[model samples]
Target: MTVTAADTVPAATLEPPTGRLSPLQQWWVLTTRGLLKVFRNGEFIFAFVSPALLAICFYLPLREAVAQVATIDYAQYLMPVIMLQSAAFVASSASMRAAVDGQEGVHTRFRVMPMPTAVPFLARAATNFVLLLVALACGLITCLIMGWRPVPEEYGGGVTGAAIAVLLVAMIGMALTLCADGIGLVAKSPEATSQLVAFPTLILGMLSTGFIPLNQFPEWIQGFVEYQPISQVTKAMRDAIGGILDWQRFEPTLWWTLGLFAVAAVLLVLGTRKAAR
Candidate 1:
């Protein structure tokens, strides 16, 4: 062949077109991809169904039992835990999705792409966030159907109490899904991720003060029940819903949230480094 510049240069050395997407645009594209995957997988439907199921399964059976034991309305008392469970559902789903991606070499492909490392991570987070909102909405509807109402008077009116309650629920969701996503990256497979995510959620949720009152638990275990992260978060949510937000009531939850965020950051660093390799 005759020697020429084009002939001498390899295709790999060609520069990208000027029309290439910016980081933000790339993020949006990836986010759309993730969201589509979630939709095709029926995660949105699960997000709605999970909270409704949790509310119905727990409320119908235990309403009478709870009423007999305490003066509180069962629906109102159960609302916080229902919200928390919705958050857990988001986390579990995120974990499985991330694991599936890892197993299918999606992560490896992404690593070789021109996008930043954080793009895929953030896109996955955004997808999980949308699912979390749906889960929370379903939980809210279920609670309303079950007679759970927020008292505006508790937080000086203007929806402040309801806003705080929603904020707390969102915080819980973000912390959990981030941590679970990172765990999924590290897990061997979707099956392993499922077990890992479910175990803590089940244990902490069942053993917490969410379903039962503190006094109902045995004295020996009461201390743990009172101070556990789930219980603390539930209590804070309850207080916010009840229009009783205060430093004393919210301190434990705040501290626990910060701690969970720290853990999530560490796990994300590890997960990204592992993927990079």
Candidate 2:
């Protein structure tokens, strides 16, 4: 069959659809498609393994050392922080992937499609959240193996409190991912993006309550550290898991996390819009 290019063209290509997807439909479709892609890429497995390995190889030893000095079980105190660290690292990398797509012209293609421009970012955020949850599960399993158990009877600490803490940490991850998206737009080049965003995030992850207790630091440093988003988020997660369950005391940290997220959202919206243009 020797058909001309014009003859072979589809009727839809000859006359493209006129209507756009509804905002809700667009978001749903994009998020689902993005998640499917992530699953196909084995991101779920990678997320689990990376954190589980770190928890075993790094945190276990640190747990042993901290156990000697700390009144509470070190693994119990450290698990929540590990979850946060895993979330933070994964979220940042996810944002970098979004930026890479932007640079590769994939984002431009999506912008021109009948979908909302925010879909890619939203999907990335959702994927990061899912991956973080998996990481949290892996961490909990590791803690259990290391002889750290949740005292459900004491302070009503059970799955409910742990789940709430996970959600909060995931929200913090979302905020950080947005911030990374903004940074990715600024860097444009992958190499530059890796150096600029990755290093600072790693440093912040270490300095923030991820590795050591904030009280161990100097008073002056503690004041500044307490104000950081990571610190507040970590504190909230710890309080939740430690069975303190004091929402009133943790509310301030939650508010701070929300404020930081709001800022990051604004930055992401502005940067993505600018990049699209």
What TM-score does model 1 achieve against the real structure?
A: 0.92
lDDT of candidate 1 over 1-277, digit per residue (tens): 5798987888867867567788899899989999899899998888878878887789999999999998888888898899889899999999998999999889888999988888999899889898888888988888888898877583432267877988898997899899999999988889999999999989999999999899999999999999998999888887776777799998888888888788888988887877888
Candidate 1 collision pairs = none
Local distance difference test, each candidate: 0.87, 0.70
For all candidates, the clash counts are 0, 0
lDDT of 2 by residue, 44-117 (tens): 77776766776777666786676666666676666766677676666666666766776788777877876667
Return the TM-score for each candidate structure.
0.92, 0.79
lDDT of 2: 0.70
Give me the displacement of residue 22 in model 1, in angstroms.
1.2
Alpha-carbon RMSD of each model: 3.1, 4.7
